[model samples]
Target: MKAASYDAYAPDNSRLRVGDVPDPRVGPGQVLVEVRAAGVNPVDWKVMAGGLDPIVEAVFPVIPGWDVAGVVAAVGVDTPEFEPGDEVISYARMPIIRHGTFAELVAVPAEFLARRPVALDWAAAGGLPLTGLTALRLLNRLEVTAGDVLLVYGAAGGVGSIAVQLGRERGARVIGTASPRNHDFVRGLGAEPVAYGEGQADRVRDLAPGGVTAVADCVGGQLDTTLAVLAFGGRHASIADPSVTEHGGSSVWTRPDGAALTELAALADQGVLTVEVSRTFPLEEVAAAFDASRTGHTRGKIILTP
Candidate 1:
């Protein structure tokens, strides 16, 4: 099977290569997905550069992807939940980074697989899992609810865009932070947009003078702005910054839950949620895709179709 792999931790992505790797083998309680599309994430590149070396060990020649949407080519023994031809999507991260989604095939635990939303095309579906799940978890952690004013940092990017919509769906008044160029885009996601950087807190105050009741920081380094605009006794959480914990906010991480993803899929089908895919690359162009992800300015997801 063809895959994109790295021989070692190379910050420049110089070791990245595309070639045939051994086909992933299915094990009991797992399903083999014939890859259709994979999502490129910042963590994918970070892992490639050994940024996560202390936490997660990587085998050399590691295939570099975690989000996938594809069809079940085969089911492992004892995997009664899925059969061949079932379309599915998953956050396919393993404790050990070896087999991954940036390949012709990947083996996923059955508990981590959810039926792909029919409302989304391959690229959108592929991009939905990780970011969507992260957004859901953050909102849940902050206990966002009707009558609460929610502020989402990085509102035009993958996780933030979904967080904006989900906050709106939960009946919160959402305020999102983005660049001047993305203000309209963020507004279209049902949030009032405030440009990030200097004076961002003032801008948010102008929108919600009572102060925001919740903050979901998708992009890090906004602890000051978040603290400034937060209402008295308000909740805050950050996926990118663990330092938030020291300031009375939670540092959040997403868990792989097929049930939660199934609910998100239903939201997509009901027109309450949508994924924005900025661009896509072929399997062989994984390097270019990673470079695009590193730009930190893309409006939505960069995907790879295998």
Candidate 2:
């Protein structure tokens, strides 16, 4: 099979290249998926540059991608949850980096697989898992409720955009921070938009005079800003900043859960959630996809069509 792979970590993505690789071997409780599309995330390039080295051990000639949407081609022993031809989406992060979804095929543990939402196309389904999981986990940690006023920093990025919509679904009044150009885009996702940076706290205070009931910081480096506008005793969580723990907020890290993904899929099917794909690249163009994601300006997801 042809896959985009690298033998060593390179910050400039100089080692990432497409070439033929052996097919993955399905293990017990796993399924082999024919990759239709994969999502490119910041972690993909970060992993390439050894940013996750302490946490994820990388095997040489690593195929680097975790978000995948595809059809099940075969199932391993004892994997009864899915069968051939079933469409699935998975946050296929392994404890170690080795076989990945950027390839033409990948072997995924059944525990990480969820049926793709009927309403989503291939690229959108591929893009939904990681960001959706991040947003869902953050909201869950914050314990956002219908009556809460939730403020989201970096509201136009992948996780933040989804968080905005999910907050609205839970009946929270959401105020999202984005650049002026993206305010309309964020508003369309059901949040009142506020421009990020200088005086952001004041803008948020104007909208929620008493302060917001919860905060989800998808963008890092805003811990002080978050504290300034948070209601007394309100909950807050950050995906990017671990310093949140020192400020009475939790640092959220998403875990792969088939059940949670299923629920998110149902929301998509019900028209309560949607994924925006900002760009699509062929598998061979994975480098370019990473470049685009590094720009940090994309409003949604960058997809790689395999």
Candidate 3:
């Protein structure tokens, strides 16, 4: 299998190396996927760089992606929801516990797999699970609804972009923080864009004269930077650094929820949700991808086309 993996905690040693390995044997309740694409998340690089020291004990040098899309190569008998050749996307729980979708094949429990929208190919579909679930959970946790004013930090990036669209779908008055280059893109998603950095709080306040009712931080450094703009008692959720919570609004961390992924898949298929791919790389170029992630600036999610 052409897999991207490295020695434990040696992110720099990680490379796109080709080695022939025995194929996986499917167990009951599992489905085998001829992996097509894998979503790249910051956590993938963190796993390599040893930056997540607090949770290092629980982490592994495993293949680093959680979101995946592929065709079902096989299915267990007890799972009647799918069959051979079913195109699907999933946040693989078991493989994440061992290997991951950064290989030519991966096996996930049947329940985690959802049929991919015929409208989306592997790259777009693979990008959906992790960020999609994070966006969905954060918006739901903040209880954003119609007429509520919400401010999204990093609104032009992966999770932020999706949250902005979801917030609009839920009827929130959406304001987003992004670079000048992405102002139009975020606006296209229905968010009023506020430039991030000096005077950012002022810009947010200017956007919401009444006050920002809720905040979601997909960007790490923008929270303390936006403190003064949040309405008193406004909720906050973050998928990045929790230091943003110190600014007095709440913070959030993401977890993989199969059910939530299902909901996101449904929304995507219904044309109510979409995933943006800023760039795509083959499995061998993972080091360069991690370097890109370290820069902290990209238009959308980076994808690994396996």
What lDDT does the true structure give each of the candidates?
A: 0.94, 0.94, 0.78
What 10-residue stretch in candidate 2 is worst by lDDT?
Answer: 52-61
Off by over 4 Å in 2: none
Over 160-240, each residue of candidate 3 has an lDDT whose tens digit, in order, gives 999998999899989998899998988888999998888888777776876888888887776665567778778777777
What value of lDDT does candidate 2 attain over all alpha carbons?
0.94
Alpha-carbon runs more than 4 Å astray in model 1: none
TM-score of 3: 0.91
Worst 10-residue lDDT window for candidate 3 reads: 53-62
Relative to the true structure, candidate 1 reaches a TM of: 0.99
Report the Cα lDDT for residue 37, model 1: 91
Model 3 alpha-carbon drift over 4 Å, by segment: 11-18, 52-61, 93-97, 243-249
